[model samples]
Target chain A: MNNSSSVIEPKTRPIRKSKIDYSQGPAPVSVNPAWCKACNICVALCPQGVLEPDAEGKPVVAHADNCIQCGACWAHCPDFAITSNYK
Target chain B: MSIAAKEAGARQDSDVVLRYLRPHVKFPNMWCPGCGNGVVATSLIRAIDKLGIPRDNVVLVSGIGCSSRMPVYLDFQALHTTHGRALAFATGVKFSRPDLKVIVITGDGDCLSIGGNHLIHACRRNIDITTILINNYIYGMTGGQTSPTTPAGAHATTTPFGNTEKQFEACDLARGAGASFIARTTVYHTTQMDRLIMEAIQHRGFSLVEVISNCHTYYGRLNRVGQATQLLRMFQEKASTQPKDPNMVDEDSKDMIQTGIIHRDTEKTELCDEYQKLTDSLAKGKSS
Candidate 1:
């Protein structure tokens, strides 16, 4: 039941945001907090554990340096919540 | 901006789920908390996106089941037919308009149990239709009843004593019934699943890709798998791609479930090809 529309906002910044480096390369990733169901499937499937749950349970880039951008998170996300520019 | 530049802009940043999913699809999918169905659906759309085919060229058809709910979200020419009739309808659609790329999405119970006959015959005909059969091992939509593919000793509401029946070997059934391409993949292996679906789409004849998905809400709880993530972890641990005898599928053993292209016979002429040949011969005879 904790989805985008029905869930209320904190009136501040969404903790989970993208650090997308598409202009440069495929190493960095981003999270669309509104689209994320907070299922954490991307978190669980990440081989590097590069992402971790934020306060609202949405996945945030916990270790941006560790992200290999193999696209496990991007492909496995059912909600289209995470975007990775893995060339 | 020009159309090409606009398309490139969307591609430069949008996640694949956003790039491929129908804009009108509901915010949250109806599947359970961590259902593997979403992963499979994303894998499929990603495959279509990779193939460079226009969305208008694709037709997604499905029978009733949790996995079949995919068409409602996919932006394609879709037909959500009655329960157990997807393949039959897809066969007609593919035959009547062979130019369209037809893909049938069905679940364990929908395709293997009630729609078993259509599946077998479709394979036998070697029709040019790709079947992405999502096997969650139990009927997730109808309250998690034991399905034909449920492994022995697995628990379901209908099989509280644990399932006594043998599980159905999906790829083997298709191989025997004459599917030209047979492959298997899992939601855990996202990349591989995407590649397999693409190959299935490209294959000239009947193709079947058995996606080993999880029903965490029911099959997992009753069978003692902790949650969707735990079940996926189990897949990561249990799946094996090493070359094993294709004939060996020991359901009783804890061996990694085989994941890859298990069978492909391209020499066999596809049904449409044969039909075209027949028409050609008739036309030649008339001219003579």
Candidate 2:
């Protein structure tokens, strides 16, 4: 009986590279800074460490290159200040 | 770093194939030119790559649909089962071989409409499987027919007059049914799709990814978003963040609904975990 339990391996190995041009710097996250109340939710929740606090404690893109464009920061931001350019 | 050194590094890395791939599976999938299933398939493969989960330890299961062809293309232990029974089959597979990572690729019609019972029970039981529901909003394989996730007033073979029934939000339904991880992403956002799939796979209990895909051949033509590019553009524009209150409307949004991971809770016990506990208790009682 060919038990459906046989283990199979991936036929091809994929290369590790960012699909987007990260060298071009962080893609700008469209934000209305004025609407941002510095809740810091974006900074705290960002898994990629993309956001950082400015001198006024406002969230800014500290490491845009690392942003995987997961949208977690944008989704969690209460103020609706963050958006991304999928284009 | 020097420019020459950087260029050399890039060249070296570019040629190296992913270590996780099985090497026997060939490229150039069977999906049509504009089918979004290819994109979703790539994202799943990429997620598998990122996690470095041994290909031998993962099992891909699917039902009848364009997306269901995913298992055939990927070099893995795949079960292309009957229409609307992928979850049921996957449940059996996971319970029997707990060591293997099981993933279910189902279409809206195949899953929600026909396999709704299995989907509901899978969530309620908190099965340890990752389900990627590719919702192109219509039955692409059997011509353009209305699906459970087809937006209200959308055109389809059966709903040429414009569908009047409400759509099923798969992620919301999964969350309501007690799924541990629920995420929603579109084919336009490939990077986010990859991240979400990786996270969902790592989650302990049942994980659902309601991937809004584009069916340019049928669904797009019927919906008036004719071209693949147009459908992708529309998804980018209309899809917004899930609001804190499900009822809260986005004032600037043209469409009332939102996208992105709507809900995720990891504290719940998985079906396998609970089952093990029950068996252990029974054994202890018998011994005592």
Which predicted model would earn the best TM-score? 1
Q: TM-score per model for chain B alone?
A: 0.92, 0.89
Rounded to one decimal, what is candidate 2's iRMSD? 17.7
- Model 2 chain B: weakest 10-residue lDDT segment is B12-21
| Candidate 1 C-alpha lDDT tens digits along B66-113 | 999999988889999999899999999988898999999999999999
Q: In terms of TM-score, how similar is model 1 to the real structure? A: 0.86
In the range B231-273, model 2's lDDT, one tens digit per residue, is: 6657877777756454656654535346667778778888888
Residue B26 displacement in candidate 1 (angstroms): 1.8
- The Cα error of candidate 2 at residue A71, in Å, is 18
lDDT of 1 by residue, A24-80 (tens): 554467787767778777776676667777777788887776664567777777776
lDDT tens digits, residues A1-87, model 2? 111111111224332333455565435355556655554545654556667766665677776666655555554443334665432
TM-score (chain B) of candidate 1: 0.92
Q: TM-score, each model?
A: 0.86, 0.71
